[model samples]
Target: MDKSDITLERLRSFVRVAERGSLSAVARELGVGQSTITRHLRELETALGVPLLNRTTRRVSMTDEGARYYANCLQILRLVEQAGDEARATRGAPAGTIRISCTAAIGVLHVTRLIFAFQDRHPDIGIDLSLTDERVDLVREGVDVALRLGPLTDSSMKLRNLGHSRRLLVAAPDYLAAHGRPAAPQDLSGHEGIRMTNVAGSDTLVLQGPDGARHTVPFGGRFRVDHGLAAREALAAGRGIGSAHRWLVDDLLSAGRLEVILPDYVPLSVPLNMLIVPQRTGIARVRLLVDFLAERIRAIPGIEQTR
Candidate 1:
């Protein structure tokens, strides 16, 4: 086998597909098409003169030859990354393309804007951002870091607790005026609800009162959307009362465009975290971005602010 035929891109594709077992997912994460990933794997196999994958319609796995090659490929890639890290470290400047995955809603309202500013400050660093609600495997997708809600029940990614994201019930003034403000948590059931697709299937909203009492409000209605920002927009447009994250609606609330429904009752808050593979944490760009995100995410309302 001639070594010159094997390109770094082809090797990367083979390794990622081997680890992920899905060309389609790898394509999405790499911002490429499935055919491209398939071609890369095919070319690599032809150059090396061996079948690297046992492929089926439902799944993909490495062949015996592939397994041995995979270990070597991993070591080669690690060395490449190490070289990049060492060079960047010697210069005391972090520069590289960082692929980031995050949900669509948060990406639109908050994360993307911050990324733009961060990019402006570090022009040498490239940002490859993917906005999707579906969960993705970071290592297989070649993502350097991700912003996700925690504590995740099943994930090995190392977590950095950015802060907590608080939930609040909010509605437009017109909607509240027309339906009448809910007198109690139970009253929320009587009003229309703009449900988000991410949090669907559960009709109950379990909240804690100021005095430490728990309240479960069963809710559902005609309005439902897959994106949280859509739900927030629908609520502001006088669609119905719905739960929203404080970071998302703080400006609207401050401007009096939306009003809090249950002032004394607070729904459970999820931890806003930065996730990265533990092994990759030493990379300078990844470390820089993590620190940048932690600093900026805290500046968002409801993250470090008192109610």
Candidate 2:
């Protein structure tokens, strides 16, 4: 026989029936209707041009040819199951290079550490990180995932919202000593403020009090930077007070290198995002990296929630 018409489903049904020696039992075990099993067996026998089972009123038994065919069916089914398992194992284990693009300062301050942690869990996965102030064309740049920390516009790319981190107005101890720390959100307008020219709404700073009260203050200074790393360096040098995310200044705050502006008021919360191509979201490696990132990044000390 050419065997072209014999389907894998038919083979599995025939094998189960032969092994169990009862069509009804095979149907119950497989959770399929008895008619389905019977059809599969009938089609399989028709394709082979021979009766594979000898049926009586009480019991069913395999003929000589049927016995030989059962042996072949078991071998084929085992091979097929092995193939499926191998495919699943490969998908389950992420092992490939991922190209990532992100803002320079946060990438250095927080994202890099997270990447190291992810690599520790998945030793087979490799990451290429590109830190820049300019927006990257993920398609042309071949970036698998891009971590963005500011406002988002309409895009065809898929975005996973990790969480929102509040911005804290911070300045070096030296700068605070020189300028005198702002006691309230409105007081920030009087002091020299480090402004981020690259982000929208940079000129106006919004601060939220512990009581859920909110207010806006105009922020400007002699120092204007488009990049956060540059601004961080300037801030570290005691240039001017600037609002930064918790992740960016966690170490500095812990080490007493920098101090918060209005302890009672917090700056606007910025959403952390991971952008991926719409079509590539289902890829095993990409999906694994995103899931791992979401889990670890949300666990960072000051993150609010993964919305």
Candidate 3:
């Protein structure tokens, strides 16, 4: 078969199998039999006259040729998507599935409501929201847009600053009353500090002290929770003073369930960002999601009011 005869369906199947690392997984996603996926991969490899994937009983991985071909395929797919987007743009309404990944707190407090409202406005557009605290690989995860907080280390992705969120040190009022408030960042050493673990097993906490000096406190605790909601609940129950996104604690603070400690020492503000993979940014669904998120996040009262 001629190389030009390789159909987009075959390319898509090959990419999916490579990304998911399993033909069975791809079959599950595509709602087809595993043998169908294998046939597509075989046809694609035959057309290209290259061994694209090393298939073994234990695992599946891309060969060097497969890696190079997959990269080119992604570019071609993105261009095709952009062409479709250009066609759709003239219709004056955005449509198609927008896959978004975001942290749990932002997903719960903001993204969910915003997506609902967006769907109401643009009924033609479909949203696929994935909420996790783990840092996702946009391309590998098949995400069109990602809502990320704090510093962005991925130079390959395009980042648009949504706004800033304050990292606050907070404790339940009862806990503060009994243990006394931390007057300084150093005082935290004397108190029970609740720590949150990310997917990579790293802990992050920021403290601002009476002297207006910022300190990033990395600590080990008797309890290490992975979810923001769990940490917030523990803090509310006086388990320990913990650090949280200001918006996450807004209701609790207003209800006097939690109180800010060392108000003068607030951690350095972290900017919330919307990121898109460079190759996919021009795609209609991806562009639409990024624009929608940027506008919605900018309008959030909690994020907007933060200095």
Top candidate on lDDT is 1
Candidate lDDT (C-alpha), each: 0.83, 0.80, 0.80
In model 3, what lDDT does residue 279 have?
A: 76
Q: Model 1 RMSD to the real structure?
A: 3.1
- Measured on C-alpha atoms, candidate 1 has an lDDT of 0.83
Query: 56 in model 2: Cα distance from truth in Å?
Result: 79
**With candidate 1 superimposed using the best TM-score fit, by how many Å does residue 5's alpha carbon deviate from the native?**
5.3
Off by over 4 Å in 2: 1-93
Candidate 1 stretches with Cα past 4 Å from truth are 1-9, 20-50, 57-59, 304-307
lDDT of 3 at 300: 60
Worst 10 residues of 2 by lDDT: 77-86
Please give each candidate's TM-score: 0.87, 0.66, 0.87
Give per-residue CA lDDT, model 2, range 11-104, as digits (tens). 9788767766788877886789999999998888888999999877676789999999987876776566545545766666656678889878
Q: Write the per-residue lDDT of candidate 1 for residues 1-307, one digit (tens) a residue.
A: 8788798899888899998998897898678999999999988999999999999999899999999999898778777887888887777666888889987777788899999999888788899998887778777667778888636653688887777888898999999889899888988888898886676454678889999989888987898888777887898899998888887888889999999988899877877777887657877777788889888888776674323
The sequence of per-residue lDDT tens digits that candidate 3 reaches over residues 64-144 is 999999999988887887777778779877777888899887689868998998889889889888998778778767777
Q: What TM-score does prediction 3 earn?
A: 0.87
